[model samples]
Target chain A: MSISARNVFKGKVTELKEGPINAEVEITTSGGDKIVAMLTEGSVKSLGLGMGADAIAVVKTPWVTLLAGTPQYRFSARNMLHGTVSSFVKGAVNCQVNIMLPGGSPISAMVTNAAVADMNLTEGTPVVALFKASHVLVGVPV
Target chain B: MSISARNVFKGKVTELKEGPINAEVEITTSGGDKIVAMLTEGSVKSLGLGMGADAIAVVKTPWVTLLAGTPQYRFSARNMLHGTVSSFVKGAVNCQVNIMLPGGSPISAMVTNAAVADMNLTEGTPVVALFKASHVLVGVPV
Candidate 1:
């Protein structure tokens, strides 16, 4: 099947934490990077998620926000990654920023052009990429 | 290293079509779903990408747009997928909509609650998910 969803991660399930309403599942990629996904508890059980099972985690790019300079403020976001700016695609309204993570995997973020100036982003600038766990979607490979 | 890039697809490059400044790469996932990514020709050469090369494509979720009901409009977006609205999570400002594609993979989209209400989305609603090829970030497995 062809999918319009741009982000797709495949890994083995390492942990599954189920709650009354939501659940957090961690999948470790072959490269050893970990991805955490937050989805509905009903969906979690319905997918029969368990440790060692193969799974995929998907998150939209707009939900990802980049923090340049020092991320002086702290929030409850489950994923916070620090990396150097690898590339920049400045668009008319929204700017696409790519940060090269430690493992060589790059994370992309879409922000307004105004924010780009405010952050003074360019190649080699250090930034933190963050997104909420609830924005992640977990699906099993059939 | 730990990172926040939520979407990661491990696949082998099945086809490579190079253009003047940009290139389109086709990757086939383990489940046989093919994904197309558009990136700079510089990146293409730098990554030494060729047919049968292993690569990873990262796309921000926000790059994904969900269109409820039959999409009768024409757009330049390269990727358009049709799926059923498998799940919905209504939020204060935006709602997270998950569309289950034909191969049992679900894609997540973040849309304003106003848009959700405007579209009258419900379970089993058929919709088209669209995204641009330029919005995709292609990376080599590290």
Candidate 2:
């Protein structure tokens, strides 16, 4: 179907965890980055998710957050990918920063222009992209 | 900088419309797709937004909604794109569905597995992805 969401990664199911209300599945993208997705227990069973299953991790760009500098404190986010500022798209209210991960995978982040200025996210700035596992959607090939 | 968002689109501001409380800015991606973003009026001015400025549109996956069949009723969403189902990764509660746009752009979406079966979204299923412009996060490159 047609949608505006980008950031789709084809991955493989490396592990699966089932719970009462929700379940989590870990998928390793083709680029070697692992993504975790949480869904309902019924979905896990109906999807026949198992080890070594091919899957696609669906992450929206907005759900992906960008950080300018590294802090010593720990956060609750489950996913963190490191990369350099690849590009910048300035908008009236927000700016889009592209963080190029180690395998040449570029993760895009949207932040306010004020935040961009406050963080000084320019080209080549080292930053981290963070997102919650629940924000990740995993899809298997038909 | 290092917050919890990813998926950034760097584009040029082709249009800007300011309302009483909120404002809408349209950015054309390098690939030529124009994405509309809505933010507060203060954000628009504080960012020094104007015509033909560079900007970014940040959108989270939860802000995205996927639909398989075409409906007769009109909706209030600001953006909608049509594509074909490229794949589906099922989870316990939700399924990640990837739709391949016309330009080979893949847009990912999250839906329940029951919705998947209800919509019958297999590979190659025609569907439409919809989202409101207000859900988009706007930013400028600092």
Candidate 3:
């Protein structure tokens, strides 16, 4: 079978913080990049996930919002990956920007062509890729 | 400003098929992943995108569906990525499954915990992630 999502991180379950409605699970990749996900209490049990358990962090491409230059304000997003613009492409309505993290992981961001022009994003441009914890999905292998 | 989304792919506009109301835009990521998006003609014109334009493709996490094992019937979803269960975290209502494609990119799927149980997805389990092209939102940075 085939799927459409583009961003997938392989890591291990580092920690699990449970709440009434949601639970926080952190997965640290081999590269030491940490990804945080929010799940339901029932889900935490169903997956039977615990510390040092192998897991992966799933994120979709469109769900990633890109910010050019340094952020002037604090963001609610739990994950903010900083990188340099390695490359970009323009479509009819959107532009795909590739940011190479210091860890060598490539993060992708889809913005508007207008945004690209407005931000003056080019090669070597510093950018931040932001996403909320609620938007993150955690999975265990069967 | 920070927006909520997870998947962001940077690619080049390889094709643009225009329609009466909507247009088809194809973006080829640096990793050779071809992302297809359908946008209103007005959006196409507003982005001023043409051949060889750069763009990014965005997909939300909830929008992704994971299929375990082999598919018995064909699906209508245009994008299907195959990978092993890198890991997953279960939520109260949903479970997040991470599939690692042969391309080394990770695709995420959000399915119900019941579905994961029914499918028996586990580590190293082969799964397919699926999504519709219409679910894809094309954007340019502002």
Model 2, span B1-142: residue lDDT tens:
7534433557789888777766778977777766677778999989988988888777655567676564532333456667788887765545677777674556676654545776667899888776667667888878
Per-residue lDDT of candidate 1, residues B57-127 (tens digit): 66555567666544333333455667788888765444678887675556667654545677777889888
Candidate 2 chain B lDDT trough over 10 residues, lowest sum: B69-78
Please, what is the whole-model Cα lDDT of each candidate in the order they appear? 0.69, 0.70, 0.72
For candidate 2, write residues A27-88 as lDDT tens digits: 88677777777754555776678889876666666678777665876768888888899887
Tell me the fnat of candidate 1.
Answer: 0.04
> What is the interface RMSD, in angstroms, for predicted model 2?
13.5
lDDT of 3 by residue, A1-142 (tens): 3233345667788988987645788988888888887765556777787899887676665678888765688998988888799987566666667788777667676677898899899999888889987666665665
- Per DockQ, what order, best first? 3, 2, 1
Q: Mind giving the per-residue lDDT tens digits that candidate 1 earns over A1-142?
A: 3233334456788998987755788877676667787755555777788899887665555768888775589979988777889877665666667787776556777678899899899999999889876566565665
Q: Which parts of model 1 are misplaced by more than 4 Å?
A: B1-142
Comparing 1 and 3 on lDDT, the stronger one: 3
